[model samples]
Target: MRRALVLTDESARHPFRASLPPHVVRRANEVERMVPWRLKLGLTRKEAESVLATYAAGFVCTLAYFS
Candidate 1:
């Protein structure tokens, strides 16, 4: 059940191979690989949102630092 949901969500996000640039798609795949699969599957909606927000904030901070 969980696996099916995960697959469905992932497919929904990337409905086509060319939906994103090659580099962006590669980077996203890399980041997804780094995540603990179990943790990702187990996270509650709010917890998942918090984790995503944290990642977004860190990405913004890193961009700011380089710029």
Candidate 2:
């Protein structure tokens, strides 16, 4: 099964820049509406794959940063 969660740009961006010790993957997208994001961990690829599937569909991946 796939687990879907919301993530903020700051949290996701950190790993993208290699700021975080853990591995974080992100897909860039532009959304017409505003939706927040969050960070998550997976013990295995299957877990991560589930999250990715959800991230790909649930949220609009983007490079936009708001500090």
Shift in Å, residue 32, candidate 1: 20
Q: What TM-score goes with each of the models?
A: 0.40, 0.26
Stretches of candidate 1 off by over 4 Å are 1-40
lDDT of each: 0.67, 0.50
What are the runs in model 2 whose C-alpha is more than 4 Å off? 1-42, 60-67
Candidate 1, run of 10 with poorest lDDT: 3-12
Mind giving the per-residue lDDT tens digits that candidate 1 earns over 1-67? Answer: 3532222234436566445455566676664347776576997779888999999999999999999
- The lDDT leader among the candidates is 1
Write model 2 residue lDDT over 1-67, tens digit each, in one string.
9855534456455544444333333333335564333333324667678888988765554423321
lDDT of 1 at 33: 46
lDDT for position 29 in model 1: 63
lDDT of predicted model 1: 0.67
